[model samples]
Target: MRRKHLLNTFAAAALRIFMLLTLGVMMTLETKADISEEYPDFYTGAEGTNTKGINFVQSITVLAPEYCSSVMGDFTVVFKAPGMKYIKAFCWRQPTDKNPGKWGHDAVLADMELKEGEMGKFVVKGDEFPNGPMTIRIHAKDDKNKQDICELQLYNLGGVKWNQGIPDRDPPGAAGMARVFADDFDGPLSISPDGMNARYAAHKTGGGDFSGWQFSDPHGENQPFAQRDTFLRIHASKPLGTQGRSGILSSLRPDGTGVAVSIPSYFECRFVAQSAPGTWPAFWTLTKNTIGMDKNDPTFEKISKMGSDELDIVEAYGGYGHKNPNSGGVYSSVSHFWGQPKPDWNQRKLADGSENTDFKPSSFRTDTLQLGGKSSWSWTFHTYGLAITETDTIYYFDDIEIGRHPTGEVSKALPAWFLINYSIGGISGWQIDMERYGNKTDMWVDFVRVYSGCVQAPEVSASGFPGAKPAVVTMSASTRGAEIRYTLDGSEPSEKSTLYTSPVSVSQPCTIKVRGFGKNLKPSPVTEYILTTPPGVQGSIGINFVTDMADSEQALAPGDVTGIAPYIQGNWNNVLAGTKTTSRFSTSDGATSPVTLNIEGEAKPEKGEPWGFSGNDRRLKRGNLVSNPRFTLAGIPYAKYDVVVILGAGIHNVQGEIHLAEAESGNHIDAFSFDYGWNGGQHAIATTKPGEAAKNTNYIVFRNVTQKDITITMKWGSGKGWTGVAAIQIVPQKD
Candidate 1:
């Protein structure tokens, strides 16, 4: 085992080395091509060093594809430069004499000051540019007046596909959930009055920020938020007065009025971390009454007396090497319950025996859970989710369970609104060394989504097959307190549609559509069913065979004996070994047939079949385990009937085998193999199966069963060597 482990480790190391080499080759080739075609003679300056040590701008490289088919969401830019004053991005569709290189001041998308050797990361919104191929140039300049520029082309599709490859991060017990709020940042950022007409508010309405930086426009006059490649870019740049200018988007407005979800809900965000030192990016939530409107609102009283809650779903601290150990690879999810009576940081307890006002932990319900990821948070995108249930608060990273804690008392009592922010060094003790990153950084968010329980689509079931006669169809929805509305004339079902009180009798051929609606819940998806009658067929012809020990009262068979397609019911008629009995079966259509069943082997059948087996448990799914049943049928009336044999026991994983052949001709007809545990092959009842217009699993139909006399042999396939023959069906096909 040790030798095998060593071999596996060596193989993994070799594979990683090979991948790195391949990536290096690809990047080298891409850089060469970009420099050769896109860069003009002046853009590619000589490597003669004048002031800065290396003159790194001559071969400036943007760590991305030179030509992107669809640029939606924020993309990272990594360049090599030993010293530079600033690096900026500009975009234009076509170059003209007025702006020959499309590098006009109007085309400037983002400009940031970078320290020596620090890369310039900016958010480029695709919609800000045109739809066709657009030229984007990244320009960098040193204090020595020496500068370098590189250009790349990108195609904008104008839409964000954020849902692609995103994992479903629904928490346990969060079933029957519906999306309540979603923001993909696919278009221009909308900043309305208190976020009333917009998805996000530019700044905090009540104005109490924990970070050293204030929430303002990082780009001076413009809003700090930008939509890039279907992502929200929050820029954090140079300081203003005592604090720096950063970006933050709050769901709550200035009046403390905004969208907020209650307890037992889920909130999630997919984002790429900034990871630059002194930068702090967070996706967190606060109680509705957290920051009231200047002590005038009644919510202010609640904050003073009852206190508020802060659920930090993710608080990512940036700093590669700093006093604080946290970096791009580690993040924390904390639940902070503020102390009551005019909440303040002084109320928090210090780590020492005595409490200190500065740099101390607050709230008795302070549960901070730190999680690590395989790669740096800024390297790629990752989803951070929080499931707030009645009893527990669960946190997830990339849909995988990370840490969980008990629900805070205050959090359970109040509704919460979310906030996404890019903060600069403040309360967090991490060093603010922006010199490495040129003093500017960015936080990118792919999307933010929240979900709660809502109305669910109704499951439709039919009593009989669609034909000349009426079929009673029942509609049932899973969501509690939801009302089901349906339409029979094929029109879309709405709240005004006919309320489903009882079973709907669908006569002739028609379409049935249903939808569920409830108070404070999103309506369910419209479920449609096209009911059609078979051509030239008054009714169907079928037969069902069960063991003698099985309950005869159960409606396990697909078609009823008295339905449009009458099916004959039969039993195995268990007797002594070598027993031969001729059972005459009668159909609802008055079709009588003589089926001579000659059992030559031992008939080992289980005792007393359970009732209600076919209703919820699916009849024939679990049944008696029998052995060695060789039955020969001489008289089959139909010239062409689909013979379906149910093999395997649902309760066990035993394999069962069945082979059928012409009795007189001794020619092979067909064979089937199944394992009860796997539920292999066709295993569903055709008529009652949902979305099964015709065929079903476990409904193996032998089309060319022309001969009347056929022999069926059943035995165990493999595994435990114990299998059961629950039932069989024969449906007549069209001539």
Candidate 2:
């Protein structure tokens, strides 16, 4: 029994060894198969009826054969496991060098257990891997003992490619590239938002986007020179299709006064290219009829019946360095003329020695000119511009002029509306690689401008008075070649109005109308003004006083009262005094003079009383006799009269009255007087009345009627002695 049992144990151990060896062989075979092929073969589980195992393991890895120049879409890894009791899959980013080994770097593990004897697949998308050369490790583990690993290589592939070649045929041709129709106008183009200094409108497809175009007018004063002067400016966001050229258009009309259009010698249009992997944008002008140039010559003739002129401004190629490089650095410029070129032909040079060359066209090319030596033109932004004038033509890129044309008088009048566009490759020599540049390249048009003739003012007129000269009438044009027309009839002036040769002369009141007209028949608004001269004046008046009297006493004393009084008397009687009863005194002579006295009078002197000279003396009393006794001299001559009164006696309480006669009519004059009192030194008085009659005697009477016994003497005319008189005379008026 013991021997039998031992043998049984030995057999069992032998079976175990055989089983382990078989398993190792199967694993070896599986590994070899996976290593020999790009994809791994699936392993069956331990169930013979289902040769599957409880735990199965499978793995996969991807290796990039070589670095891909370009990559598109996503990279993927796929695998399937069949006949496994259950399976779990794991994927990890691995280096090509470490394929089919433990994924040491960052990795994602799928450790899900599956049902017995089930089939499963594992897939990993490309983005999961790194950019450079890489590998993907895919591992599948099932319920069975089998484990498998597979490695796949990854590569880089770039974007799609495309090409736009030149046009195979030509479109119909209109007159010259640029033509100014006779119907064009020279007046200000009426812009909607009236006062706007400068503005531009563009026509584009696909909902226009102008972000790519940059605009700048450093000097804010001047308007951008557009159709009237030269061309428009455009820039591209990507390589433009060269299949068709771009177009820039303009229109002109008479403002109001008349109908005429003035043209410049030359004009310009400009464009820029997108600096991308592959892109080339070109600018060109074409007749309105041959937009695509699909129609033949006969078709162009039919279109020409509609009146249109076309011109190509510039064109460029983004690829080929024949002129520019594959990287994009080439440009070209050309101008088309309508009929015969003008006398001072070349528009590039002005008579003033200034360059008329357009800076827009050559600006972009010169910017990348330095890159021309390189194999590929470095992708970068570019700018271009073109300017044309009656006497000159200029072309520029980014403010840099690349070309110029000296042909003067390109057009006698401004050209009709023309078209401007940017094309990738078209009739012009432009061939661009669309693939390198992407699907679409953007072309931006900043604006189009026209600068033509200046507006002129009208004539002015003056009227009413003689020798009235018309105000200087000044006029100016927006550009040039504008003539001023004016009339003095107050009527609106037209083109037929008389031309203003010089300032108008006005001797009488009149209204003037003025207007400005261009050589092309375009007219400006009429300006009008009314003028009147002033009238004249007549005869005058003059008067003067000649006197020998310098001193105040002499100037105020009466001529008849010659002497001064020394003593006080009981009844002081002089030619200046009058009796209380009569109340009047007459002067010895017809002349009159003024006098001063110290006395009292119950009744003041009457007209011509106490008078000594040519004028009457009328005494004017103040209040009642009880109050202060005050009197004024009256009836003085129409001329200046001087008077002086003197007191020679002791202090006396008395009332004094002095009077003068009025002068005759037509007498316009003035008077003055001076007085001297008894202890009180001197004083003065004067008088004059308009239209008063002159008289012989003017007197001043004094009556000693005070309660106290007062004694005083009076004097006039130098006031030396009691020459006595109530009045005096000194003058006959002089002029």
lDDT of 1 by residue, 157-274 (tens): 6623323333455444355566556677777776532343345665664556655566763223325666665666676666434346677888876434455666667888887654
Q: Which stretches of candidate 2 lie over 4 Å from their true place?
A: 1-272, 275-312, 321-327, 338-383, 408-410, 413-418, 429-432, 436-438, 453-735
What's the residue-level lDDT of 63 in candidate 2?
A: 26
Model 1 bad stretches (over 4 Å): 1-173, 217-222, 239-243, 290-303, 322-328, 340-373, 454-735
Worst 10 residues of 1 by lDDT: 1-10
- Give candidate 1's root-mean-square deviation (CA, Å): 26.7
Candidate 1 overall Cα lDDT vs. reference? Answer: 0.53
Steric collisions counted per model? 13, 183
Could you report the Cα RMSD, in angstroms, for every candidate shown?
26.7, 42.7
Candidate 2: TM-score?
0.25
